[model samples]
Target: MDIIQLLEVLKPAKDVVTVQIASQKDPLTPWFDLAKAVLPAAATAFVAWRAMNRSHRQFEITSTRQAAEFDKNLAQQTKALRVQTQIATEIEIKKEECRNVRDTCAQYLSLALESNRYKNDFDLASEYILKGNTQFIEKRNVAHENYLESSRKTLSARMLLMTYLNPETSPSFFESIKNVDTSLVSSAPNFGGVVGKCLAECRMYIEKKQAEISTIATE
Candidate 1:
């Protein structure tokens, strides 16, 4: 071939090579720019997702702690209420016991007064018997002696009543005496009816008071 013909063929080949290189470089330039632009956005999205997940976990933990605290407070309040109820029940029981003691004392006092009256009657009966048998001066002496004995018995009964009913004094000894005297008076023949009635009434009062105490104690 001639030089000009060879030159024309080489020129077309060189131009084709240049056009391919430029096309590849054009696509690569845009791809590098896109990667550079998206890198920061992708990193930011990752960081935001991690932060949101951490916040969610923190909130869950806080909620759990709050729930636990609430349960503890509820338990404490329930315990307090139970303690208060127990204390109140004890107070009521003590109050009932005091009332029972008072009523029992009153009953004993009533019995003592009744016994004094009966003793007075017995003294008068004795005087009548003695005076009916005696001459004039003897009858007067017997009546006077009987009156003195009756007065003495009445005073004794008064003193005994005071000992039982006084709040300043302890009623323990009187309580023991109450059962013994009630039994003794009940067994007596002539005075049994009057004494038995008084004993029965006193017993009834005691039983009622005991029932009240039991009811309070149960609470």
Candidate 2:
């Protein structure tokens, strides 16, 4: 038979049958199935890890900030303490100077009295008076700057001049500085009523400074 006639003869008897495919897909391949099963869990684990890492970083930052603040506070306290200590040391030094000045001034007063005893030798009296005055001025400077400069305890030049001539002769010195006459009160250098009174004031000043220093230390 001819090829066209043979093809025509191979056709179905009644009609050609048609096949229809369903909408849904079949099961996936092995690798795709494994990904489908594990991807969600892996994604969840990744997200949780990221959250934990973020929290850890935040904690580290907070701890670092707290540590820095603590250091700053400690440094401030240390500086304040050092300043208080320096102030206390300075006050103590001033107290010592005050004591020295008091002793030296008492000695100068006694020396002046001794100089006045030489009534016959004018040159000797003048020499001793000049020496005592110079020594007293030198010793009184520091205490005067601190205590007497603002008060009536300061010695005037005129008063010092009279005191240089005679230790207990100056009315201003006797009235303002020391009340009683040293010779009449006592012959000893530091035992006179005036010396005692001045020393009391010095002690009072020292005590006041000590109280202030203590207050600073405590605060």
Top TM-score prediction, candidate number: 1
For residues 3-112, what per-residue lDDT tens digits would candidate 2 score against the true structure? 54555578763554444766876567677989998999999999999999999999999999999999999999999898978877876875665555455555544543
Question: In candidate 1, which residue ranges exceed 4 Å CA deviation?
Answer: 1-39, 115-119, 122-219
Task: Estimate every model's Cα lDDT from 0 to 1.
Answer: 0.59, 0.53
Per-residue lDDT of 55 in model 1: 99
TM-score of 2: 0.42
TM-score of every candidate relative to the true structure: 0.45, 0.42
What's the lDDT for candidate 1? Answer: 0.59
| lDDT, residue 14, candidate 1 | 52
Report the lDDT of model 2 for residue 168: 45
